[model samples]
Target: MGPAQKPNVCRQLSRRALGFFSRDAGVVQRTNLGILRALVCQESTKFKNVWTTHSKSPIAYERGRIYFDNYRCCVSSVASEPRKLYEMPKCSKSEKIEDALLWECPVGEILPNPSDYKSSLIALTAHNWLFRISATTGKVLEKIYLASYCKFRYLSWDTPQEVIAVKSAQNKGSVLARQAGIQQPVLLYLAVFHVLPFSLIGILEINKKIFGNVTDATLSHGILIVMYSSGLVRLYSFQAITEQFMQQKLDLGCACRWGGTAGTVGEAPFGIPCNIKITDTPPLLFEVSSLENAFQIGGHPWHYIITPNKKKQKGVFHICALKDNSLNENLPTVTASGRVVKRTFNLLDDDPEQETFKIVDYEDELGLLSVVAVTQIDAEGKAHLDFHCNEYGTLLKSIPLVESWDVTYSHEVYFDRDLVLHIEQKPSRVFSCYVYQMVCDPGEEETTNRSCEKETNLNIILNSDNHSSDC
Candidate 1:
C-alpha cells in the first residue's frame, strides 16, 4: 500500500468516537481505499480559516480575509475569497525526512509587539522547531531547531520581556512508553529565545534526576517558574539565563544544574539569581501570577497555587495566591517564606457527581475579572463550562457542551480583554472556532457583569495534497 493508504489512528479514533465508522469490515476497507484514491487525485493542499485577532479585527490566515465582528467582513467588496497571505516550508522529493509519518502543521500565535513594522510577527512551532514568520509578506524571519525527536510545552510569548519561552523533552519514540512498561530517559530542556530577530538567547537542560521531572513551566515577570513531577517548584531568572549565554559562560551543549542542593553551583542560595524551592507537594499545578504588590523592599508578584479538590474540597480548586521571598537568605525556611492568600474556589454547591473541574483560562480587565472553568462531561456526555467573575465567584453563564455540533473544552480558549475564542477540532479533522464578545454593566459598581454576545464563528478545514498528506 502507498503512504497515503495508511490506517491512521487519529482519524480512526475521531471517526469511531463520533460513531461515523461503518461496522461492516468490507465496507470499511472499501472506504479507506476510496479515501486513498481521493488523496491521489488531489493536486494541492488548501487550509481553511486559521485565524488570529489583532485589536478588534480577526484575520483569517491562508485566505487573508478579515472579520471585524460577526456582522461584517473587513474586505467584503471583493467577489472571490482572498488570496493566500503567507508561505510555509514545503517538502521536496530529494529531501530525506526523519519524521515522515509523524508531523503536524506549524501552530502559530500572533505576538503582542508594540511596533509599527511588525504587523504580522507570529511565532510558529512544529515538532521540534520554532519559526518566526511575517504574516504580511509570507516571509520567515528566523527558524530555530530544538531536538530531533521531542515534544514541546510551556510555550508563551512574554510581551514585557520580549522573548518566547518554550520547554521541550525527549519523546522516547512512542507516547505510550509509560503505559507499556518501558522506561524512558528523563530529559527536559528549557529554551528562551529572542522574538524579534529570532536568536537563541539561552538554553538550559533541566536536571530531572536531581529536581525530578518537570511537570510544567510558566513565565512570570522575569522569572521562569518550574514545577516538577515530585511537586517541588523552583524559580529561575530569565535575565540571568540570557546573560550567561551572552557572556559566553554557558553553551548550548552545556547542561546547567541550577537547582540542586546547596553548593551545587558554588554559590550561596541568596547569591544565585533564583534558587528557591517553593513547594514540596507532589500534585500541585502552577498557574499564572495574579497580582503584583510593591512594598519597602521591592515589588513582588503573587502567583496562584492550584491543587485539585480531590480531598477535603471535592469538585473544587484549592487555589491560593502566594508570594515567595526565598531569594532572601535571611529567611530560614523557604516554604515558610511564602505568603498565601486565603481565598479558594468552590463555585458549585450541589455537584454530587464529583466531576473534575479546572480553571482552563482567565483574563482581568478594569477591576473586572473573568474566568472559564470546564467541568468533566456527565453520564449523558454533556460537558459543563462556567464563565464568571473570579473575585465574586458568581457564575455568569453555565454553557452545556455536547460533542456533535457545539464547541468542546478539548481545545484551549484564547482571549483578550473583550473577547474569548473557543477553537475545537471536530471528528472530520476540521477546526471550529467560536468567538464571544464580553459586555460589562456600567451601572453596577460591586456586581460583576455576566452578559456576553456571540461575535463570530469560523471553521477551518485542511485540504491535503500529494506532497503533504492529512494534517
Candidate 2:
C-alpha cells in the first residue's frame, strides 16, 4: 500500500468556526476543526458570498458588484456566479479583487519620505486613523502624514446615491467614500462602520448573537469635531469634519481628524508629527532608547506577548518566547512549536500585520495545523482560546513551549470524565497570541484532581490520512 496521507481534521474545524463568526454569531463549530479552518484559511479558499454582506442582496453596491465600502471601490466587475462564492475569479477591469496582498500589503504601510510626492489623502470613519492609497490601485499609496494620539476605533460612510461602508482595522471595517476624491464625503457618519477590507478579515461577535442586539447604541453613525487628537470635545463632530476638509488645502498635515470623525487617515491623526498633540495616554510616550542588552521575563507561562513595531516588513514568524524585557535587550527568540513545528510559515510581502501567507497547496495534507498557521493577520483586535485535549500530550514534562510563555493563567476545574488534559490555545490575539501546555498532574495530584485519572493514561493523536489513500 502507498504511504498514508495525513487526515485534515484541523482545516475542517477552522472553516466551520469561521462561517459561524462572520455570519451567525450564534453559528458555532460542533468541533475544534470547524473554528480552526474558518479563521485560519483565506476567505477566498472557501466560497464567496458565504456571508450575507459578501452576497448581493445581503451586501452589494447599486452597480451590481461587491462594493468594498472601506476603500469605496468596486471589488471587481466580472461578478462570480453567486453560487461559487468560494471559487476564485479572473482579474478584470470592473473590480480589482486581490487575496494575496490582503493582510499585509506593504504599500499600505510604507511611509513616504518628505521628497516623495503624495497626491490625495483622506481620514478613515471612526477617526481611528487615516491613510493614502494608490489613487489608481487603491493600494495604500503612501503614509506620509499621521496624528499621534487617541486610537481611532471605527468609521462608516454614506455616499450621495445611498451607499455605505465602514472603516476600522483590517479585521475592523472602513467606509470608503469612493465617489468624491479627498474633498470630504457628504452625509458621512462617524459610527456604524461594519465592514472589513476586501480580504479574509473575519469577525466573531460573541457579545450578542452574531448581528443580534440592534439598539439605538452600537455607534453606527455620528458627526463630531476634535479640539485636538485627545478626548477634548469640540462643537459638532460634523464641524471637525468640515474644518479638517477645508484645512487639507492649507495644512499639509491636517487632512485627517481624530476624536470621532474618521475623515480618511487610518492612523493619520494618531501619529501626526506637527507638535499639535492630542490625548496622551498614561505617562509620557515610552520608547526603547537602547536595544543591545536585555533580561529574561517568563517562567513556565502559557502565552507570550509580542509587541508589534510601528513599522513592519515581510518574513516568516517562528513561535517566540521573550526571555527578557529590560531597557537594553537583544531580540527575543521564539520557541517554534504547534503547527509551526512541522511546516514553514511566511508573512505577507506587503504588510505583515494586515495580511499573511495563505497556504494553497498544503490545506488537505496538514489538517488542523494548516488552520493555525496558513500565516495569520496580527491586526489590532480581541479573541479567546478554547480546547479539550487527550492524554499522550498531557504526559509530556518540562515542555520547551510551556516555559517559553510570557504570561499564563492557572485555573483548575473538576470534571466527571477520567480525562487528562493536554491541548490549549490563546482565546484572543489581543489577550495572548498562543497557548502552551506543561506540568501534568502527579500521581498524588491526580488522585485529588477530578479531570485526571491515576489508574490509566490516554493518547489522542490520530492515525494516517484516509482521503489521500482511500482515493
Candidate 3:
C-alpha cells in the first residue's frame, strides 16, 4: 500500500465490492439479502452512497419500532429487524425535524385512561407544530400548534391507567429593558394537552422565584417532578389535570382550583386548575449550598441526582426514593423531605485522580448503571475510558478501553432487553460499534470473568480505527 498505489487499490476494491453485490448467483443473492435485513441502507446528500455508512443520529426504540433520523432531514422508523416502515417528510421545506417521540397512553400508572382514547401515538414536534401520527401506519393522525407563549423545551409521556416515556425540546423569551440591575427574563410554563383530540388543555405559569430556573421536568406515576438549577426539587400533584381529561365531557363551570383562568370548548382549556399547591408548601428535595449547576436527574421510581463536586472533581450521586404512595396509590407520591443526605454517595472513589474525570453520559440497563468516563489523561496525548459499573455504589465491572484522545462515542441501551450498543469513531472518519450483552447472573460469574480478558483484545481491535477508502 504505497501512497501512489493507494488510490488505484481503492478503486479496484470498490469495483470488486460492487461486482460482488451485483451478482444474481444463489450464494450472492442469499448473502446480499441477509445483509440487507441486518442493516438499513440510508441515502443522504452529504455522502454519495451511504449504503454502508452508520448514521450518527440518535436511535430510539419503543415497543418493537426503531426510530432514527437520516441526515437528509427525514425521521424514519422500522421494526427492530431492520425493515423500513416510513420516512416522514421534513417538518417543512425550511425546517428540519427537531424531535420525534413514540408515546402510549393508558400508561396506566400516572393518569387514568380517557374514555375515547385507545392506543399509542407518534409525536413529531417540528418548528411550531406538533403532529400526532399513527405508530402503525406512520400517517399523520392529528396536528396541534404549540402557542407562542409556552416554549416547548421537552416532551415527557405519562403512564396512563397502560406506560412509556419520550423526550422533545421546545423555548420562551420576552423583551427586556436594559438597565443596571435588569436580568433577562426566564420562566417555566407547564402546558397540558389532550392527547386524543390533540388540543391544548391549559398552560400553567409557574412562579420563577419558586425555584430559580427549571432544569428538568418529568411526569411519572401521576407525580410531576421539577428540578431546578439550584438543586431544589419540587413535587406537584398532576391529579387536577388527570381528573379533567378522564371525564367524558368538559366541566366549564369547574373553576381552576389553582388560581388560573378556565378552559373553553375551544382554545387553551384551563378549566380544571392544576392543584400544584397540594400542600401549602411542597416538600423541597435538595438544597446543595456547595453544589455547582452541572447536575442531572436519572433513575426510575428512585430519582438519582448526579452532579460533580468541582472542588474534589469526584461525582456525587444522590438517590431519593419517590415518596411512599402505597396507601395513596391514586397519584404518584413524593419522597419525604429529610432523606437527601442519608441516601447520597460518591460514585467512584477508588480512582486515584477521580477529580479529573468527567461523566460524559450514562445509561441504566440490566440492573446495572453503565457510566462512561474519560479517565485522567496521560502524557502521550492519548486518553483512556473506564466503563464504571455501579449497582447503586457496588462496582461491578470497570473495563478500560484503548487510548485515544479525540474519539467520538454514541450509544444506545435497550430497556426491553439486556443489550448495550456503543459506536466509537475517530477523527479519521473511521467508525466501529460493539454490542455488549450485560450478563450479571451469579451463576454466570465464572463465564463472565473469563470474558473480561477478551475485552483487552477488543480494545486492540478498536486501535485500527482507520478504514480503507471505498472510493
Give the best candidate by lDDT: 3
Pitting candidate 1 against candidate 3, the one with the higher lDDT is 3
Candidate 3, 216-315: lDDT as tens digits: 5666655566666564555556665444333333333332333234343322433233222221234444433224544344456644344444456545
| TM-score of predicted structure 2 | 0.21
Pairs of residues at least 3 apart in sequence or in different chains that clash in candidate 1:
none
lDDT of each: 0.39, 0.25, 0.40
Query: Across residues 333-364, which tens digit of lDDT does each residue of candidate 1 receive?
Result: 32232433454554656663445554356543
lDDT of 2 by residue, 1-471 (tens): 222343365665566656634454334423444444333332222111111111111112221223232234333223221111111222233333211011222234443353223322233423333343433344454332223322233423432112222322222123453343332211212222211221111111111121122111112123322122111222223223333332232233335553455444323333432221112111221122111111112346422323232124222222234344332334333322221123446534664333222211222311321111121235332212212122111111111111122223222111101111112223341211111212222332312322222111110100012211100
lDDT of 3 at 129: 48
Judged by whole-model lDDT over C-alpha atoms, candidate 1 comes out at 0.39
Give Cα distance to truth, residue 206, candidate 1, Å.
1.6
Model 3 off-target regions past 4 Å? 1-52, 56-64, 70-82, 93-95, 105-121, 160-186, 194-201, 209-228, 238-420, 423-471
Q: Could you tell me which 10 consecutive residues in candidate 2 have the lowest summed lDDT?
A: 454-463
Alpha carbon lDDT at 314, candidate 2: 21
Tell me the alpha-carbon RMSD of every candidate.
21.4, 23.4, 16.6
